[model samples]
Each structure stands twice: as structure tokens, then as C-alpha cells.
Target chain A: MNAKIRALISEFGRLSVDVATLKNEADLYTAGLTSFASVQLMLGIEDAFDIEFPERMLNRRSFASIAAIEQAVSELLAEAGRDAEAA
Target chain B: MQTQEDYLAGLLEHGLLFSTGVDGLFGRSALFEATVDGLNALVTKHGDGFNAESVTYPPSMSRVDFEKSGYLKSFPGLAGSIHSFAGDDRAHRDLLADLEAKRDWSGRQKITDVVLTPAACYPLYPLAASRGQMPKEGLCFSLCSWCFRHEPSRDPARMQAFRQREYVRMGTAEQVVAFRASCIERGEAIVQLLELPYHLDVANDPFFGRAGKMMANNQRDQKLKFEMLIPITSDEHPTACLSFNYHQDHFGLAWGIKTADGEVAHTACVGFGMERITLALFRHHGFELANWPAGVRQALAL
Candidate 1:
């Protein structure tokens, strides 16, 4: 979990130096992650998790912070697991 | 060197401009018709195994669809939305008064579910996605769509509303790349046949925000987008006649378009600004179709 968080932070940090300065839960918009960058970050997250992100989850709120992305990822993974079990 | 003004003046004397303006809302005419014919002729001559299949799309698209495709996030400034009212007479009166006052009436307005499609490819994605999996070979579609842009300019190259002829293909990475490459080669051949001086150059889409900028840069470096530019008015600066775009797995993922193997498909598109190309032809050739080259005329079947 710590390693996951660090990986997330490192990706966010590449987007902005301010992300590294933040203690926790920094607003991504305030951290200088522009909309285009957010999409790139989402692509990165998708690659990292080896998961296809649904269209519904693509929005400013979902990408607002490292914590938010982690939470979304966890939810997606849980949903995927449920789907697998049902299958 | 002959100036654009000088050529336009000659065309005006030939009654080409007036005829174009009178016959069409968007300055279309007999000359324009002839130019389109010429283009078709050029396409047949140069396009490898050209099979012309035409499609006309609705002027508007579902706003929800665009939202799903992330268009709203990228091009909010360029997008135009439809609005309507569902209120009493007093509310209607208030809205009317706001309209009369030329104030911000958007607050009183409720946005409709649809928006005017800014380009032809916007609608094709949904159709392609619905198919689930594309064949290993490819799916090819031709569309002539009415497109709208919010920012209107007086330049003939830049119109508030225009027609676009686009060819879109979806398939495996190799197929998509091959499709774009073929389009580039054919586009250059067509330019040569038209006897127009042109150049093929790397181009970028105006992606929104900083992330979009980075993506644009990546696209540029990868040569994912290319434009065939020809001078219309001035010899110094040129207008883009055709554009070839390679969207590697982007639209495929967004729209759930997959290959036969269940992997995301690669997509590419060739867009021809019918009017801009017509304008270029007119600027290069002359107003009289009879005076044009016999080879060009025969190719157009004119």
C-alpha cells in the first residue's frame, strides 16, 4: 500500500512540483495539473493498474487528488472482482 | 505575379461571385459545382481503387455522447449548444425581455440534450463503437457532414458553417497506419493532378488544457497528424486542403471499438474541406471551366 501510494505520488509529482510539496490530499487543479495532463495521468493510471477506465469515471472530481484516484481504482478493482466472480 | 484580388476581380466580371452568392447561402455556384466535379475527377485518377460511398449526418449530436468522448472538456470554448424554455408566459416574457436586453440569457435558458457537430468524425465513433469488434482488415466509411464552428471568420478558408468530406477507417494498428499512409500518398497525387503547388507538413489538433498540449506535442513528434496545404489567396501562406489523422487506440478505447482479437483497434481519418479545396482550385485555375485543362476536365467527366 505504501509502495502504491509512492508510485501515485511520483506520477502526480511529474505533473507538478507542488504535488510533492503537499502533505496530503492537495487539490489537483491547485497543484497545476491541467485538464490535458489529467487525461495523460489517467492513461498512466490505466497502464499501471492494467485496467480499462470506464467513461463514467472520467471527470475532474475523480482526478482531484492522489487519494481520489486510489479510491476510484480500489472501487474499480472491487467491481472487476465482483464481475469476475459472477462470470 | 497575379494577385488574389486581381483573380477575384476577373471572376467577379465573369459573374462567378454573384452567381455563387445568389444560388447558395454559403457562396456556392456553377464554378463551385465545376470545382467539386474537378476534385472528384482528381480523386478517381489518383485515389488507389477509389470507391466513393457517401453519407450525410445530422447537423447535431447528442451532448451526452460528446461528453462521453471528452469533447466538452477539450473544446468547451468552440462548442455551441442548443437551448430551450419550459416555463409559463411570465417566464417566457422574462426570457424574451432578457433576449431583448441582450443580457446573459443563458441563466434563463436550459441546455438541450444535443449540440451541433463541429466535425464529421464526431458521429462516426459511436457507430464504430457499437460494432464491438472491427474486422482484422478494416471498416471504411465516407461521410459528407455539415459542421459548425462558433468562431466565425470572414476568410473563405474559415467558415462558421461548412461541409466536410471525410473517410474514416478502424482496424488493427498496421491497418490504421497503412490507411493514413495511403491517404497521404493519394492526397499528394491529387494535389499534383490539380496542378496546385502544395506541401505535406506535420500538424496538431488543438487539444484542450496543458495535458492536451503535451498530447499535441507527442502527436506532432509521432507524425500522427499531417496536412496538405496549398496557397489560396496569398502565395506566402497556404490553406489546408486535406488532413490525415492517426488516432492509435484513443477513439477505439473511448468508443469500445476493438479488433478481431478483442484488443483496442487503431483508427485513422482523412478529412477534405470541400469548400477550401474548391477555393484553392479557383484561385489556382480560373473561373471558366471551359478554359481549364482538357485532362482535368475529362477527369471530372465535365
Candidate 2:
């Protein structure tokens, strides 16, 4: 899961720093990821995880960092799993 | 040897755009009007067989609809609510006295039901909703309107009030996404036909605030918005001349725009900033249409 999220960030995040060198909690925007680039990153995460972000979760806190994103995606995946089980 | 300011000054001098000393408001001269009309016509002809329902709307729309559409959630700073003098004669007298004394008199005006339409596509969703369920094949609407934003600029391209021509698609996700892609292709082709060199790139709306930054980032990450940019005020930081946006059920769920199957509809819109395009044409092809390359002139039929 860590490797996949990191890879997605590197591929679509348009970050200035190398993904391998940075800590998970480092501020991506401060390090050079633009708002435009973060959007690209978010789409990549959605595709990789096969999750559609609900409007309630479309805020900045959802994509604030590698850690925050992982939490959001993990929670979403868990919810979807529960939904599928119920279905 | 020419700067953007020089180019803009040339526009004013040539009477292409009349400047009232305001940053984003201008009057179009006969030549400018002809060029805009021709360009709009050319675009319409390009999408000739889409069978899009053409709709023209006044610059203002119902404030209730505007608020319900979640416009304030995304762009509170940019929305302009209409206000008018809703006072009796005695209050009017005070207002006039205040105005004559050059004091604060705006208190007399009350907020009205209308807000300046921020985008050409604003009213379409509600109007479509009123018609009941969207068809299985979905709907496509061609719209033209005077849109307003509070951000004023001297760049001439970034006007506070400008006309936008848009084609909005509503349907299932597959249909709307496909429609958006086709429009991007069309936008690319149109700019080329106009002979304006541009770069197409993933883009985001200028959402406000710290939280808004995240929203923009998410939007960019999703690849939901793409803009065709041309160098106008600055070559290094080119301005967006056209924008293609996929709303992805944001409007559908809010306004209860549902497909025939009762699922939330997906939406996308391709917007052409008319004044900016007109400016870009003048900037790239020189102020006089006669001096523009023969092909460009022929395409616009100028």
C-alpha cells in the first residue's frame, strides 16, 4: 500500500522533490507541488484505488499529504469493502 | 518591441475595444463586434451537427438557484448578488443627500433575487431539472451569456464582465466524459484554425482559501479540467483562452438532475472566453482584420 501510494504521488503529484527522499509527512506544496499538480495527483489516486471521491470528502484535508491521503483512501476502501459485503 | 500594454493600447487606439478606464469593462467597436460574431459563427459551424439546444440567458439569474447550486461554497468571493434601491421617498431623500455629500449611501439598496451569472452554464441544470428526468441519450446545450467575476484586471483578457460561449453536456458518466473529450479536441482544433499558438494542459479553477487550495489540487489530480492557453500578457505565463471542465455530478446531485434511470447525472462544460479570444486574435493577427493572414481571415470570414 505504501509503495503504491508513493508511486502514484510520484507519477501524478508533479512534485519537485523525489518521492524516495521525502518523508511521508513532508509538506508537498511547500516543497514545490502546485495546486494544479495536486489535482493531477488526486485523480491518479482515485484511479489506482478505484474509488470515486464523494463530494463530502473533496476538501483539502483529504489530499494534504501522503499520510492523509493514505488514511482517506484506506477508510474509503474499507467502506467500499463493507458496502460490497452488504450487497 | 511590443509589450502586452502596448498591444492593449493599440486595441483602444484602433477602436477595437473602447476603454472606460475600468480594468475589465469595455465597449466593442464595429470591427471588434464583427470579429466576435464571426468567431462565434465559425465555432458554431464547427460543431454543426451536434444538434445542441441553443439557449441565450440574461446576465442575472435567481439568487435562490444560485445559492442552492453550491456556487457560494466554491466561489463566494466572485459571486455578485444584485442589489437595488428599495427605499421609500424619505429614505430616497436621505440616500440622495448622502450621495450628494459623497458619503456612504449603499445602505439604501437591498439585495434582490438576482445574482450576476458567473458562468453561461449556471441556469441550464435547473432549467433541465424542471423538464424532468434526463433522457437515456442525455442532453447537450449551447449557451451564450455575459458572465461576471469580481476580479478586475488591466490585462484586457481577464475581464470582470465578459461574454462566454459554452456547450454543456449532461448524461451518464460515460456520456459526459466522452462529450468533454470531444470538446477538448474541438477546442484544440479551433485555436489552431485561428492560428493562435497555444499549449493544452491540465488546469484547476481558482478556488478561494486554504481549503479551496486542496479542492483545486483534487480537481487537477482528477484531470477534470483542461485549458488551452495562449500567451497574451506574458509569454512565460500564458493565459487560459479556453477551459474544459467536468463537474462529475457536483451539479447533478445538488440540483437533483437525474438520468432517466434515476441515477445522478454527470456534467461537463467547454467554455470559450469570447473577449479573450477576440483579444488574442487581434494580438496575433494584428489589429486590422485585412492585414491578418488570408487563411485566418477566410476562416473567420472577416
Candidate 3:
């Protein structure tokens, strides 16, 4: 999941620096992930993960760092799995 | 203690502004026009040392260019598109009949190629880009235009159609950032010269929707925008009479504007709301231009 997120970010984040050198907790915005690029990253993440980010999570903090993105995606994926089993 | 309505009514009573039946639309009296003119001249005098290329645009802009600006994506609620009656004789008759019956005649109208100019500097980017790469010294532009936003309010300061005087700079990030910094100082000086109490603070555009919240937050975190606020309508919610923005290559990337150093040129702009500043002067000094303070009168040369 971490590798996938980093790959997606590298492809769509348009960061100023290389994503491989940055830690999971490193700030993506500081790496030059612009507002427009963040939107693109969100879309890319949604497609890659096959999960929708709730409107409530659509904020700066949700995408502030790679670690933050990983956590949010994990929680969302677990929520989706639980909902599917309930159905 | 006067209420907001009372202040607006006082302006109408004093013949400074005339009601046009619409909330935000009003006819400016000669006194109001003179004050706005004087304020514009004052802005020009302050910017006289920049050697900026001066340009004036009408109230409308090319719809194609406006679309390219992506303004709708961020401020869909505030954009205004021009529409015209593009119809044949039969359609015209139908439209007149609809109007006579007070029905929906807008169905016959068609959208035109022009959209209302939202900001004075919006049209400058593409124009600059078309002129080829920026010089090493960069480019600075002085512009004044009747800008439009769809916000209709009775605040008198938030007019739907208003004039803006702006200075825009384009070049490297360092050049653009320095220009914005200089603008902040100049903005402060202008407000001080007018003798109006003001506070300069970091600000953001009213971007739309949930995603826009992130955008606004990101803008503030980056310290890309600032405004000079004055107590025009009220003390609690002071009006933003002056704005300073650093685009940081946003326009350059979108418009293909390149610098002499072979990188995307960054951009910055400082804008003055002509009507809002004039209204602030009236509110602070007095409704009567003749009775204004000596320094204020001298600065405006009234």
C-alpha cells in the first residue's frame, strides 16, 4: 500500500523533489504538491484504491503527508470491507 | 449610532450614490465619481516609479480566455457571462410577447463570446504570454478596469460592478515575491495617506466547495495572498480595500508564459477596489467632500 501510494504520488503529485528520498511523514506540500496537483492526486488515489474519499475528509490534513494518506486509505478500505461483509 | 442601512441611506440622501432599484447596482453622483477619480490618480502617483505598462480594459472579456482562466472552477458562484438576443424576426416577436406577458424571455437569449471581467489582471497573463518570454528584468503592468462579480449586496461596498486599479508583475519567483512585498508596503502607505485606520492581514479568495476549502487553506499556509482591511461598512467586518497576491507560476504554467531564464514565469498583483476606497474615505472623513480633513483633501486634491 505504501509503495503504491508513493508511486501514485510520484506519477501525479508534480512535486519539486523526488518522492523516493522523502519519508512517509514528510510533507507533500513542502515537496511542491500544489492545490491542483493535490486534486489530481486525490483522483489518482481513488482510482488506484477503488475507494471514494468522503467529503468530510477532503481537506489539507487528509493529504498533508504520505503517512497521513496511508492511514486515511487504510481506514477507508477497512470501512469498505466491513460494509461489504454486512451486506 | 447609525446602522448599516442608515449609512447606505445617508449616502443616497447626500446625493453621493443614487439607487438603481437593484441592491448592488447604483448610479454614482458627480462627487462620488470625482472622489474615485482622485483615488485612482493617487494610486497612479504611488506606482509612478515602477514604469509599469499601462492598460485599460472594458467591463467584459473574451469568454474563451475566461474559460481558460479556470475562474469558474474556483468561483462558479461569482462569474457572470454575457447573453444577447441572437434570434430571427419570429424569435424576436416571441420574445416581445413573452416580455409583454412578463414571462421567461431569457430563453430566446443566447450566450455571447464575452464574460464579465472578474479581475483587472486576469486578462493580462495570456496577453503577456503571447508577447513571448519575459525579459530578465521581468514585466510590470498598471491596469484599471470595471470588474464584475455576481455578488449583489446592500453593503454599498460590495457592488456587483466596480472599478479596480491594479499593478501586475511577472518574472521569476523571486521577482514576483519581491513585487508582492513591495505592494504590501505601498498598500499600507496609500491607506495611511488617506488617513483611514486599517489592518494588513493574510487573506484568501473565497474559493467554492469542499475541495475549495483545501485550496483556501493551502493558499493561507503558503502566505500567497494578503489584504488591507478598513472599517467601511462596520468595524467587526472591515472591508478589504486593497489586495496583494503572488501567483507563483500558476498563471505562467497555465498560460505558457516563460521567463528569460527558461523557466515558467511567476506572477503577482496588487489591486485597489476604487469604489470601496472611495466609500471608505466618505465613511471615515464625512459624507460631504467639502468638509473633509485638510490632509485628506490635499492628498486627493479635492
Candidate 4:
């Protein structure tokens, strides 16, 4: 597994553990991924990625699942790379 | 299963001590004093090493100001108006006589171009806008303002008249998020320190109309708001004592809050209901200030 993906999963697992017991593929919502917790997750992701999540991407669908969160992070990283190169 | 009325009566009987005469809409001295002491303790402890400057605002705001910010357009239902007698005393008496006779007096009055601020932070946005660009990091302010609402509900929790203590920050998105998160943490800490049982949950502001429903949905989806609820009476449903909100770029775009680099600044606010929190404390600990826990009393320096 990619180190970034592993860290993300581990962090999500930790948060889920704090609220409820969860399997690796357990639905995050059922695992207590509340709206407030989603924000905390976003913050954690930002910290782990060292990138600022844009306002446009701060939405429920973006943080709905582990796969969605990973996709969002990849997009942000790609955008950051593009911006860096453009600069 | 005590009703809201029973809860309020219990507060009046055991918890509330009036420090000032109740001759007017204002001047509930006991409540005010307790509020000040509570806020002082909160700021001194959690807000240590932070400059705590205070701000007072006018009871009413210019209609044009609110209009410019889309408040009137958004919340016409909650807006309160100011009016003046356009005619002489004789005409006013005649109008009063007509009112006594069950006739309309609307034509005899002129609605003034002002409205009472529904919340403290409403006025600050314009001031922040006028200040131009925010510093790269941010600007933090504490505001206490007299706010009025037209909701006729007599619930003490839903007062038509109240005071709001607000802490506002304007800066980068990262700063705004961090600031809001810190407030949530500190709010939970303070509630626990006071030994007040509470729950943290997502909450939404009362938005105006159909558009408001959409706005609220967006706010919830974005995790723009969270509240700390402490039961004033029952544990099943609790009253909100503190709320933390992150206004991503909404107010920044509206009020022109900008970073030193000229980008729109993100904004966040932490609001403490001075009166409601006092009411909650009274509900939990009873009226005698002496009976409050030693640690709680010591923390408040009471």
C-alpha cells in the first residue's frame, strides 16, 4: 500500500475506533463519521498531506468515504503540483 | 419531565438573584454580573497570553448597512423596524384616538431607515470591511452587543432581547479552521472545568427562506457550524451554550474581508450565550453562589 494511503486509513481507523468498532471496509457514516468529525478528518488530512484543501472541494461528497477522501487528496496533490510547476 | 415553564420558575425561585431593578428591558444586574465573572474566568484561563480588547456596538444598525450585506433580503421575517410619528402631537392624538376606535394608524407613521441588530457580529463585518485588508495571519476581536429579535416566544432561552458575546477572527482558510477547532476544544474544556455535562453536535443557524434552506444544507454539508449543548433541565435535549462557525468565504466576499495579499480572507466566530450559560449553571448548581463547586467558583474567581 502507498504510504500516504496507509496513513490516511490508519488515521480514519483511529477516529472510527474512538467512536465505534469498525472493520476496514465498514461504512464511515455508520462508524460515526459525523459532520463535525468530517471536518476534523479534513483537518487531519490537510496536516498529513501538507496541503491546503480548497474551499470548492470542502463538501460532504468529498469526505464521504475512504475512497473519496483518497481521490480528493490525489486531486489536491496533483493541483498543487500543477500550480508549483506553473509558478 | 418538567416543562419549560417549570424549569424557568425553578430558576427564578432558586437560581436567579436580581442585582438590579426590573424597571426596563435591560438591567438584570445579577445575570449581568455573573455573566461578566464567567467570561472573565473563561478568557483569563483559556485565552491567556491573548489580548482581550472589548467592543460595544449601537443597539440599532442602518438599514442600508444590513441591506448591503443582504440581511434584510435574507431574513425579512426576523427583522425589526424603527418608526417615527410623521405628524404633530395633535395628529398623533387623533391617530391614537383612531387606534382606540379600532382604526388603522399605519398611514400616520413613517418607518425609519434603521433596524436593530439581530446579532453582535452583524455590525462588525462592515467595520472589518472598512478596515481593508486583514493582516497576513489574522485579526481577533471580542464584541458585546445588544441584539433584538422579533420572535414572540416567551421562552427565556429564546429571548426577544439579549446580549451576545462573540469572538471573531478573519484570515487565511487554515487560520480560520484552526481557530474554530481551538474554540471547540476550549469550549469543551471549559464546560468540563465547570463540571457542566454537555454534548457537542452539529447545528445550523436559522436561515431566512427557501434560499435559506439551501444555504443551511450547504452549511451542514461543509461542516460550517458546531455547537456545545448543555442541558438546562433535561438530558435528552440540551440548550446550546457555545457555537463555533467557520464562514469559509461567505462573509469575506460579502464584507470584503481580504488578506494582506488581497485574497478574500476566511472568517470564523465563537459565540458564547452569556445569559443562557448563566441559566444553565443556575439550573445545575442552584441559586446560592456559595453552593457552586469550589473549583468552579475558584475558576470564576467568584
Candidate 5:
């Protein structure tokens, strides 16, 4: 998930720095991630993880780092899982 | 004045704008105001035949709806949320002291009920949905608002706060798309009437990130956004004075705006950035409004 998240950031984020050497928890914006790029990354993450990001999850902090994205995806996946189990 | 710097300096010299020492925020001079009013009049004249429901929104709107509009999701960098110093007496005193000391105390501010209206038509979609499903012919509305973006730029055309006049159409895919095309045509006619050199071409919203890159490319490939650009600061990279956008089902889906068949209604909006258009006119006709061509003046009813 970390690798995928990083890849998505690199692909969509328009990083001003080297994505390969960047740490998973490093600040993406400081590394050159624009809000436009982050939203693109969010859409890509949704497609990759089969998770629809709820409205509340859309913000700068949600895509602040690879870890933040992973956590968000995990929460959404877990919610989906619970919903499926309930059904 | 061939350069961007020269053009900006010229506007300043001509007293077209009253600077507040901020790059993007400015007060318009009387002639500038008249020019904007002229652009507004032109837009109204051109859009009259469309039979749109005229609507106007306050410069501010609900922050909640702004979030739901996916504005922050897409353009958080440009989003302007109204903030105020909501502090106790001590904090307020500290804020004043910090200001007196020339320290950055803006962080002490709190977000208010208002988010600056990003687009003129944003509030309309939910309003349309609340009235229940759209009819077969769909709906059309005209709106004008003072919109805000956070981008502070030296370019006079890229104002942080600007007025937009928009005619929005919501209906089936065919209806909305047709409306966009008509807007493109109508937009072209007005540009011609103003006697300004312009080029209308496919454009994309500046989406963010790798996914946004793809989205931008897709929008262009599908011919979803078209910009009516005119030379402002530069001839090579003209500013978009007007835009024809086909939002497809994005707004309909987001705001629960549906057609009579319970299908997500496709949406399209054509917007005229009044200030940008006025600037374009100034760029073309020179700074003195009195010296402008009689035909152009007559076209704008100035």
C-alpha cells in the first residue's frame, strides 16, 4: 500500500523533488505537491484501492503524506468491509 | 508596452487600478468601473435570448456547500475561506501587539461561516435540486457574483477577487452540450462585437497531481472545456476572458440534481470573467475609454 501510494503521488502529485528517495511520512506539499496534484492523487487512490473517498476525507491533511493516504484508504476499506459484513 | 511588466506599469500609471499594496487585490477607478459595467451590459445583451433565470448570489456562501462542491478537493490552493480574529480580550490584545510589532498574526484568525464564492453558479445546482427533478427541457439560469481565489499575482488580469457572469444549463447530455456550443458561438460573437482579437480553443481546468494530469488531458481530449482567450499581458499566452465548460454529470451527481427520469442531469456553464474581459478591451483599445472606437463603445453601450 505504501509503495502504491508513493507511486500514485509521484505519478499524479507533480513532485518537485525525487519521489524515490522520499520517506513515506515526509510532507508531500513541502516536497512540491500542489493541491491540484493531491486531488488527482486522491482520485487515483480511489481507483486503485476501489474505495470512494467520503466527502470528509478530502483535504490537504488527507494527502499530506503517503502514510496519511494509507490511513485514509485503510479506514475506507474497513468501513466497506463492515458494510459488506453487515449486509 | 510589449512586456507583462510594462502592461502592468501602464495600468498603474493610467490610474486604472487603486493598489492596496497587494498584488492581486485592487480598487477599480471610475473608468475601470465603467469598463466593467460595459462588459456586464454586453453580457446581458448577448445572453438575453437564452431566456435564462437571472440569479445573483452574495459574495460569500456556506463553507459546507463549498466543501461539498469539491472546490477544496480540487483547488484548495486557490480556495479563500473568510477568517476573523475570534479571540478573547487577551488574545486580541496579543494580536494587536503582534501587528504593531510587524509579526505575522494571521494564524490567530478563525474560519468564519462564509467561504468566498469560488464560482457564480456553485450555489445554483443545489438550489435546482431542492426544487425536485429537472424537466425534459432542463433548466437554464444566469448568475453573476464576486468570486475569489487565493492566487496573488502581478498580472492585473489574475485578480484574487473578480466578478463572473455565467449562464448555466442543466439537462440531459445533449441539451447541456448544445448549450455549451451555443455559448461558444455567442461568446465568439461578443468578442467580435468588442473588436478584440481572440482565439477560442479547447482548454482544461488546472487539475492537481498525476491523476489530475490525466484528468486534464481527458478533459481536453473529450473537448469538455473551451476558453475564449484574448491577449492581456502577452499575445502568445492569452488570458481566458470567457470559458465554455461541460461538466457532464459531475454537479448533478454531487448535488442530487436529477432529471425527471431519475438520471443524473448533465450540466454546462459558460462564464465571462468581466474584469479580464474589460482588461482585454483596455489592452486592445488603449487605456483611455474616451478614445475607444465608436463601434466598440456602441457594442458595450458605454
Candidate 6:
């Protein structure tokens, strides 16, 4: 999940620094991830993980760091799995 | 002690503003216009030091450029698009009949190629981009325009059609940030000269919808915008009469503007709310300009 998130950040985050060198808790906005780029990253993450970010998850903190992104994706995937089971 | 309604009524009673039957729309009397002009001149006096190129735009801008600016994404509610009658005689007859019958005749109106200028600086970005790369020193512009927003309210300061006097800077991030800092100082100085009690605070645009909440939070987190507030209608809820914004390459990326060193340029602007400040002046210094403070009168040259 970390590697895939890093790959997505590399492709869409438009950060000034290398994603591989950064810590999971590194602030993406400080690394030059603009609001516009963050939206693109959100779209890329949704496409790659095959999960949609709910309206509640659409905020700065949710995309503030790699760890946060990973957590959000994990929770969304778990929520999707539970829905499938209920069906 | 006066409420917004009281202040608005005072303005009307004093012949400062004439009623136009619309809440946010009012015709300024000669005295009101003179005060507004004085405030505009004061802005120019402070901004002249920047040596900015002067540019003036019409009240409306190209719809295509407005869309590219992404204004709709954040402020769809505030945008105003121009529309006109484009149908044939038959449709015109129907429209007149609909209007005569008090039915909705607006459906016959077709959207035009222009939208009302959301901000004085909205048209400047693309023009600056068309001129090619920014100089190492960046570019600066002094602008004033009658801008529009759809919001209507009883607060006279929040006019639907209002003038914004602005100074825009574009270049490297350092250059733009420095420019913004200088404008902040200048903004404080101008208000002090006018002898109006004011405060500056971090602020955000009134972005529309649920998604906008996050966007507003992000903007505040990044400290991208600030406003200078002054008591107009009341002390508790002062009006934002001046604004400082740092766009952080948003305009550069959207307009394909670049710096001399081959990096995307950053942009910043400081806007003076002309009508709001004028209202503040009248509210604080009394309706009669002759009784205003000597220093304030000196600063405004009124």
C-alpha cells in the first residue's frame, strides 16, 4: 500500500521532492503539493484503489501525509468489503 | 449603536444613496461618489510606489477565461453570467407576452460570451501570460474595476456591483510573497491614515457547497488569504474593506505564465473594497465630511 501510494504521489502529487526519500509522515503541502495537485492526486488514488473518497474524507488532513492517505484508503476498502458482504 | 438597517436607512435619509428597489443595488449620490473617489485616490497614492503598470477592465470578462480561472468550482453561487435576447420576432413576441402576463420571461434569454468580472484582477492573468515569461523582477499591475457578485444583502457594504482597487504581482514565489508583505504594511498604513479602527485577520472566500468547506479549510491552513476589517454597520461584525491574497502559482499554472528562470510564476494581490471603506468613513467620521478629523481629511484630500 505504501509503495502504491508513493507511486501515485509521484505521478499526480506534483511534489517538489522525491516521494521515495520522504517519510510517511512528511507533509505533502510543504513539499509543494498544491490544492489543485491534491485534487488530481485524490482522483488518481480513487482510480488506483478502486474506491471512492466519501465527502467526509475530502479534506486537507486526509491528504496531508502519506500515512493519512494510506489510512483513508484502507478504511474505504474495508467499508466497501462490508457493503459487498451485506449484499 | 446603529444596526445595518439603521446605517443603510441613514445613508438613504442623508441622500448618500438612492434606492434602486433592489437590496444590493443603489445609486450613489454626488456626495457618496465624491467620498468613494477620495478613497480610490488614497489607494492610488499608496500603490504608486510599486511602479505597477495600470490596467482597467470592463465590468464583464470573457466566459471562456472565467471558466478556465476555475471560479465556478469554488464560487458558482456568486458568479453572474450575462444573458440577452437572441430569438426571432416570434420568440420576442412571446417574451413580451410572458413579461406582460408576469410569467417567467427569462427562459427566452440566451447566455452571452461574457460573465461579470468576479474580481478586478480576473482578466489580468491571461493578459500577462500572453506577454510571455515574467521578468526576473516580476510584473506588477495597478487595477480598478466595477466587479460583480450575485449575493444580495441589506448591508450596504456588500453591494452586488462594487469597485475593487487592486495591485497584482507575478513572478517567483519569493518575489510575490515579498510583494504581498509590502502590501500588508501599506494596507495598515492607509487605514491608519484614514483614522479608522481596524484589524487584520486570516480569511477565506465564501466557497460554495460541502466540498467548499474542505477547500476553505485548506485555504486557511495554507494562510493564502487575509482581510482588513473595519466597523461599518456594527462593531461586532466589521466589514472586510481590504484583502491580501497569495495564489501560489495557481494562476501561473492555469494561464501558462512562467518566470524568466523557466519556473512557473506565483501571483499575489491586495484589493481595496472602495465602497466598504467609504461607508466606514461615513459611519465613523459622521455623515458630514466637514466634521471629519483633520488628519483623515488631509490623507483623503477631501
Name the candidate that leads on lDDT.
6
**Model 5, C-alpha of B130: deviation from truth (Å):** 1.3
Given candidate 5, what's the lDDT at residue A26?
91
The TM-scores of all predictions, comma-separated, are: 0.72, 0.79, 0.90, 0.71, 0.78, 0.89
Measured with C-alpha atoms, the lDDT of residue B208 in candidate 5 is: 59
Q: What are the runs in model 1 whose C-alpha is more than 4 Å off?
A: A1-6, A9-87, B1-25, B37-54, B101-106
Which ranking of candidates, highest lDDT first? 6, 3, 5, 2, 1, 4
C-alpha lDDT of all candidate models, in order: 0.72, 0.84, 0.89, 0.71, 0.84, 0.90
Model 4 lDDT tens row, B174-244:
98798888888888888887788888888877876544554556678667899999887566778888899
Clashing pairs in 2: A39-B217, A39-B220, A39-B221, A40-B220, A40-B221, A43-B221, A43-B222
Question: Tens-digit lDDT track for model 5 on B84-143?
Answer: 998899999999999999999999999887899988998888799899987778899999
- TM-score for model 6? 0.89
Query: Interface Cα RMSD for all candidates?
Result: 8.6, 6.6, 2.6, 7.0, 8.3, 2.6
Residue pairs with backbone overlap in model 3: none
Candidate with better DockQ, 4 vs 5: 5
The positional error of residue B178 in candidate 3, measured at the CA in angstroms, is: 0.9
Candidate 3 per-residue C-alpha lDDT over A1-87 given as tens digits, one digit per residue, 9 for 90 to 100: 888899999999999999999999999988998788897788889898888888767777889899999888888988877442222
Each prediction's total of clashing residue pairs, residues at least 3 apart in sequence or on different chains, is: 3, 7, 0, 0, 7, 0
Q: What is the TM-score of chain B alone in each candidate?
A: 0.85, 0.97, 0.98, 0.88, 0.96, 0.98
lDDT of 1 by residue, A7-85 (tens): 6656743555644466457786676565456676777776767676665566667767777777777778787774322
How would you encode candidate 3's per-residue C-alpha lDDT over B133-251 as one tens digit per residue?
A: 87899999999999999998888989999999999999999988988898888888888989999998898899988657767877887888999999887888899999999988789
lDDT of 2 by residue, A16-61 (tens): 7898987878777666665445666777787877887776677666
* CAPRI accuracy category, model 1: incorrect
Model 1 over residues B83-174: C-alpha lDDT tens digits? 88878899989989998999887787788898888888888888888877766566887777778777654455666666777888888889
Best model number under DockQ: 3
Docking class of 5: incorrect
| Poorest lDDT segment (10 consecutive residues) of candidate 2 chain B | B208-217
Q: Name the TM-score of candidate 5.
A: 0.78
In model 3, the runs with Cα more than 4 Å from the true position are: A3-32, A43-61, A75-87
**In angstroms, how far off is B30's CA in candidate 1?**
3.8
lDDT of 5 by residue, A44-86 (tens): 8888777777656656677778878878887887877744222
Name the regions of candidate 4 deviating beyond 4 angstroms. Answer: A1-87, B14-32, B49-53, B102-107
Assess the local accuracy of residue B273 in candidate 5 as a C-alpha lDDT between 0 and 100. Answer: 95
